[model samples]
Target: MRMNPTFIVMMKCSEEAGVQNPVFQRLYICLGALKKGWKEGCRRILGLDGCFIKGFHTGQLLTAIGVDPNNQMYLVAYALVESECKDTWC
Candidate 1:
């Protein structure tokens, strides 16, 4: 589906809201992007910060992995940690 001005890429509900399910539409869009270009030269050292939740629990330190332009091992992966550790992260 062509992206309209009001098309929501993602949503929390399964039921249709404004237009044909925004979530599905967004999924399709993402899939299209993936198909358009394969992951290459995207790997790089990934640095991530902690992420918190909305519950009765303390915030969590997490990491995110991604590639760089040179396809080098960027942020490898995200792991829950007690605190921020730069040396341990990279």
Candidate 2:
């Protein structure tokens, strides 16, 4: 088993829709502790899943998970994307 690597990289992007409207384009959040834990204590396989969101602003909840030695799911990263497009995946 490997431990998750530590990191501290976060990104947020947006664009102005109108004179007073700002639309969220993309967001990425990853923690160093989570990464280190994953690398040190988690298995090699990584699971990815998401679902369509329903509300005022529609989007998807994307997540990355890994299995640990005890076969437990470990959360690695998460994001809220407008859609499951190729660009978003990358």
Candidate 3:
């Protein structure tokens, strides 16, 4: 955040029934550089997708992508959430 004032980072946590403290539920990140680059050089069209994450951390990985003027893929943003559901997407 210090490096990029426009950067955005968010974290969500929830308390379990018997947990003593809040547990991490989700995280979202969008770098300032990436966002600026997308807005200035990428096409208006955007594509969103998600996939399940395996191993130690079990969740979903969501991504937003766009196309550049050169017709190449340009990653806009991404997030890690507990699940791929309507609520999570929002």
Candidate 4:
């Protein structure tokens, strides 16, 4: 955030039984450069999608994409969430 004032990074945590500290629940990120580029040169249309991760750390990968002038897919933002549901989407 210090490097880029427009950069955004948010994290959510929850308390669990027998845990001294809060457990990480979700994470969202948006790069300043990508956001600026999308707003300046990319189309207004946006595509949102998600996929499940299959490794040890299972979670959902959500992404927001945009179309550039050349009709190429441009990544705008993304988030790592526990699951794909109404709560996470918001």
Give me the runs in candidate 2 sitting further than 4 Å from their true place. 1-12
Model 1 alpha-carbon miss at residue 28, Å: 31
Candidate 2, residues 1-90: lDDT per residue as tens digits? 145444544545666566566657667777778877899889989999998899898988888999989998999988888898998866
- Give the Å shift of residue 13 in candidate 4: 1.8
lDDT of 3 by residue, 1-90 (tens): 677899998888997899899988999999889999999988898999889999998999999998999999899899999998787756
Residue pairs with clashing backbones, model 3: none
Supply the global lDDT for candidate 4.
Answer: 0.93
The local distance difference test score of each candidate is: 0.40, 0.80, 0.90, 0.93
Higher-lDDT candidate of 1 and 4 = 4
Kindly indicate the candidate among 3 and 4 with the higher lDDT. 4
Error of 4 at 37 (Å): 0.6
* Top-scoring candidate (lDDT): 4
Predicted candidate 1: what Cα RMSD to the true structure?
11.9
Off by over 4 Å in 1: 1-41, 68-75, 85-90
Question: After superposition on all CA atoms, how large is the RMSD of candidate 4?
Answer: 1.4
Error of 2 at 18 (Å): 5.4
